[model samples]
Target: MTFSRGAVEEIAAALAASGLILRGGFSFGDDQVAPAGPSGAPAKSVLLVGQAGAAPWPHFQRWLGQQARDIANPLDTWSREVIGAVAQGRGARAVSPSDRPYLPFQQWAMRAEGLKPSPLGILMHPTYGLWHAYRGALLFEDEIPLPDAHVAIHLCDICVEKPCLKSCPVDAYSGQGFAHEACLGHVRGPRGEPCRSGGCLDRNACPFGTDYRYPPEVQAFHMAAFARL
Candidate 1:
């Protein structure tokens, strides 16, 4: 069935109520986003979905165990399964962040929401802060009208203190760009206890959206994943 923006939004809201937020999206003619489709068929548009703060973790944790088999990357696995099911149910195709020839979700997000990056390189959401994440996106053959993207006031621009810079133990993020190796090294070291068991100190230090911070256990899960890779 052909879906209108309102109908798609209803789907988005339903998903959001279950823990995933339809972050935003874009519409393109078939020729524009060609060759990226899972079946190699052109998609008319894509809607981005994500997790904000601790909202999705509880839902995800509960869903994780019911899986019939164990998987290495449970988060990615679950995201694809759930989002794909939803999209398929609605006659759309589901895509993931890990999809080959990766979709530039960050750029898509910026276009979708006119968002700018934080000092730590994470997108500084006006409301969700640095605590949110893009899980996956849905591609549709049916056309949906695009929403107007407006630039929000970048929270980092006005913040003079910039505590995210100083809060990190290893000084991993700065004007020099993310010292990925340095971060991994520190997370593996004894002094990385707080970060290893909790989460990135710099990310947690962002004052704009403290209320939306991921739970320690959730943060620890992601940190552990980063440490392993």
Candidate 2:
């Protein structure tokens, strides 16, 4: 079954109210494990939901204010609540990046967006850069008509300086993959105040998509979460 353009627009509108955007989608191939639908059949399509930069900060802050002070995984909880509602209203299943037995969101994103990973391991979009995120996805039982796929262009290939790899104090990303312990240690230490207050120096060093960069507060929130985990 094909979903009409109006149906897609309606979903976009609903997500926009909460500062989320439909980040494109794709139909599951025969070889892929399409998530099970309500009737225990495989879902045919997936519409990715995400926010560009700090677009969802206000909406998230407002919702955060009303929740319990000791809530665990508040951001993920909020995402599930918001995306789950949209999914339920439209007769679809909701999945998140944080879900156990993870749904290969990174691979799915690259497929849907034609984006490639930067040295930092984040999907580097031509427009959003390192500042965007995938909150959740809506899975449908039928194939939904989607817009054309993005043309992949790896910006890092042409970059000369590659500032991102050099900016980290701990050399956490020294072209040898991320040093998780070193990163965690520094971010939680006193010397990490700069990163704690602003954000990852390496991430901020990226010159692409500067306009979509997240604000200091938003970055700080994510940094705090990272330090804890």
Candidate 3:
């Protein structure tokens, strides 16, 4: 059934009540427009969530699981949730994260749309810096009413020291951009030290997301996701 934006707002309110804060960014999941139907009209709507003081990780997982019971059998990941919501809205084949068409299509879309990669190679919110992460982005088949929000381009623009760049013991963050291999090496290498204790030094150094720092256990849970990769 097609849901009105007000209905969506209500649903979002409910989600927020559960400790998820809907955050606006320069883009959803790195500003990649989650494509919708076969015609590619763009997603009718997108849902973005942020954990409050702590990463309400379980609530998010449960939300998806509950959604599946009412909708498809399994709308597991962000991509799946996006696809299912869009399909429900459009009543046709929806976009799928695992659809194989999406991965490469994203790059092509970025090129076609002139969506430039952030100089940071990571989203630099005015508030949240590397400390924050995008856990998931959901596209809806039906447009969920939401206020227009400006996506944050550079969270560090005014800051002078830019500790995120300086904090890296290994110099993973280049002034111009990020060196992924360098970042992973320091985090994963047996020789890695500081990173083993807390988390990415450069990331932890960011002052934007200090208020939003995940609780220790929540932070640990997400850090493990990175470590596993």
Candidate 4:
């Protein structure tokens, strides 16, 4: 099925109220299979939905305030509720990065947005940098007419100093892959006050996309969640 530009715009407008953005989209190819939808049929296309920086923080905080204090994975819950509504209204299926089967969101993101991984293992955007995330995706059984994918310069390639690899207090990202335990220990310890209250020093050190960096409160929320996990 053909999706008109107006259709895409309408979807964008619906998500904007909740501070979500339509990151990008692509149709499934033979080499890359489409995920199965609720009907057990393969979805023909997918439109990625996400937030840049702290765009969804206010909406999320308001939602959190209204919820039970002990709710688990509140962010994921909010994403599902919001994106699921859009999918229902648009006759599509909603899927998330944290779904049971674990869809290839990272690979799909690379294809859709022409992004590459940074030293921090986050997909580095040319403009948004590391302050963005893929919350969910809208899956349609019909092939949608999406804009042509354009190549973007990998910001990490041009980054000479690679400060993100060196700024962590624990040297968590010491090039041998993330020192997960060491990073976790530091974030939970008394000495981790800076990162716990602010954000990951390594992530914050990246000079790119300074304008889009998340505020301290938002970073604190994410840091707290990471510590819990």
Go through the candidates in order and give the C-alpha RMSD of each one to the true structure: 2.0, 1.1, 7.2, 1.1
lDDT of 1 by residue, 1-229 (tens): 6777678777787687559988888777535644345456687677889987888787788888787655688999888877877776676778888988888888888988889999888888898889888888887766677767889789999999988999987899999999999999999998999998889998888789888998889989999989999
Clashes of each: 0, 0, 8, 0
Candidate 3 lDDT trough over 10 residues, lowest sum? 108-117
What TM-score fits each model?
Answer: 0.92, 0.97, 0.61, 0.97
RMSD (Cα, Å) of model 4: 1.1
- Give the local distance difference test score of model 3: 0.50
Query: What's the true lDDT of residue 55 in model 1?
Result: 88
Q: Residue 192 of candidate 3: its Cα lDDT?
A: 64
lDDT of 4 at 90: 78
Error of 4 at 118 (Å): 0.4
Question: After aligning candidate 1 to the native by TM-score, how far in Å is the CA of 58 from where it should be?
Answer: 1.3
Each model's lDDT comes to 0.83, 0.91, 0.50, 0.91
lDDT tens digits by residue: candidate 2, 38-122: 5579999999999998899999999999999999999999999999988875868999999998888998899889999999999
**Better model by TM-score: candidate 1 vs candidate 3:** 1
The window of 10 residues in a row where model 2 has the poorest summed lDDT is 32-41
Candidate 2 residues lying further than 4 Å off, grouped into runs, are none
Q: After best superposition, candidate 4 residue 28: deviation in angstroms?
A: 0.5
Provide the global lDDT of candidate 4 against the true structure.
0.91
